[model samples]
Target: MHILKKGLVILFGSILLSIGINFFLVPFELLDGGIIGVGLIIKYLTGMKPGLAIIFLSIPIFALAWFYNKSYFYNSLFGMLFSSFVIDLLSFSRGYIQLQIPPVVSSVFGGIFVGLGIGIMLRYETSTGGTDLLAQFLSKIFKINVGIMIFIIDALVICLGGLLISKESFFLSSLTITVVALFTSLCTWNDERTKLKTS
Candidate 1:
């Protein structure tokens, strides 16, 4: 039952994340953060599939997780696989729905869904791997806040995307990342408070 619950959480979270990416962010050329953002940029540049890019790009991170953190590896492995798979499977959305709304609005909604998805996974004690795991490892070694590392990594990716894509993409992508970070933080705030009370 416990395992099943975890599986469901991963499935739902991945679906939400994919929806935000395909339906909102991708259509507008906006971006989230971390490796997911990188995958999108790869797709934007090379005509490659974002999901395929994600799966391929994730290899090194998961490899590191395998050696350094068995628990994180097992927790994130399936989430990563399913999320990538779903993102590819949902590619039909590229032509199915194209909204002519403002980029800022799309960025906000995109961030909400993406952040909510990730936050749920994290709250459930799992994640989609990628930079989140890398952040954890780096934080352990450097004694810096994982959140800060993640933000930096995200900013780098978005900046690169902007350079390669467009100034508008860069600016809107920055907004998307900010919104995602804010919502993700909100989702985990309760968890932090609970942990504090328990500790």
Candidate 2:
């Protein structure tokens, strides 16, 4: 029952993420930060699928989660897999529905959807891995806030994406990531510290 609940959360979260990416971001060639951004760059360069790239790229991140935090690994593994699958599934629906809006509106709304998906996963004590594991590890070692760590790593990824891709992609991606960061931070703040007290 617990497993099913978590799986459902990840499933819905992945759907939202896929909607943000395929319907909004991908059609515009807009990049996002973190592993997704890296995968996008790889796809742009190699004509490979982003979902496949995500699965391939997540291995190392899952490995890190395995070694650093077993709970995190177990929680995130299925979430990552299911999210990747959903992304691929929804990618096919790209032609059916698209924003056709301006880049700025798309970026903002796309970020909201992406962040909400991630927040739902995190709220359920699961993750989609990638820089999530990195941020967790850094938080453990550096005593920094987990959200802050994630933001920093995302910023670095955006910067590298800028240098690797075009400056326009970098700028748009940064906007997307910034909104995602803000929403995720707001959603996850103090979420884990609350507990029920039995009388």
Candidate 3:
């Protein structure tokens, strides 16, 4: 039952992520951070599929997880692959759905959806791997807050995307990631509360 529930959550989260990326972010050439941002940069530059790029880029990260954290490897493997497949499957939606909203609005909504997806999966003890897994590994070693580590990695990715894409992409993606962080924090806020209550 627990496994089934987690699978469902992954499915739902992947769908939300797909919607954010395909219908919202991709339309405006906006970006999120982590491997997603790197994937988007590759997509924008080489016309490669972002999902495929994500999978390819995650190889090294997954290799690290396999050796250092077998549990993380198992937890995130399906989430990453399924989410990537869903993103590719939904890529056609970009051509069909016209949001007709301001770019800022789109960016905000995109962040909301993406953040919610990531947060929900994380709350369930699963994730789409990539830099999220990397951040987790690093945080354990360095005794840093995972959130802070993630933020730094995300900021670097956003900056890289902006440099490769455009200044507008930089500024707007910064907004998008800020909103993403806010919503992700909101969703995962229960963790702190639970810890406090138990203490």
Would you list the C-alpha lDDT of every candidate in the order shown?
0.83, 0.79, 0.86
In model 2, which regions exceed 4 Å deviation?
192-199
- Residue range 47-110, candidate 2, lDDT tens digits: 7888889889989888877787799988888888888788888888877876669987888888
* Candidate 1 TM-score, C-alpha based: 0.91
Give TM-scores for every candidate, taking all chains together and pairing residue i with residue i.
Answer: 0.91, 0.91, 0.93
Tell me the alpha-carbon RMSD of every candidate.
1.9, 2.6, 1.8
User: How big is the RMSD of model 1?
Assistant: 1.9
Report the C-alpha displacement of residue 124, candidate 3, in angstroms: 0.6
lDDT of 3 by residue, 1-199 (tens): 9999999999999999888888888888999999998999999999999999999999999999999889999999999999999999999866777889988888999988998888888778788999978876786678554555666788999999988999988888888888777776676677745755786
User: Clashing residue pairs, candidate 3?
Assistant: none
Model 1 lDDT on a 0 to 1 scale: 0.83
Provide the clashing-pair count of each candidate structure.
0, 0, 0
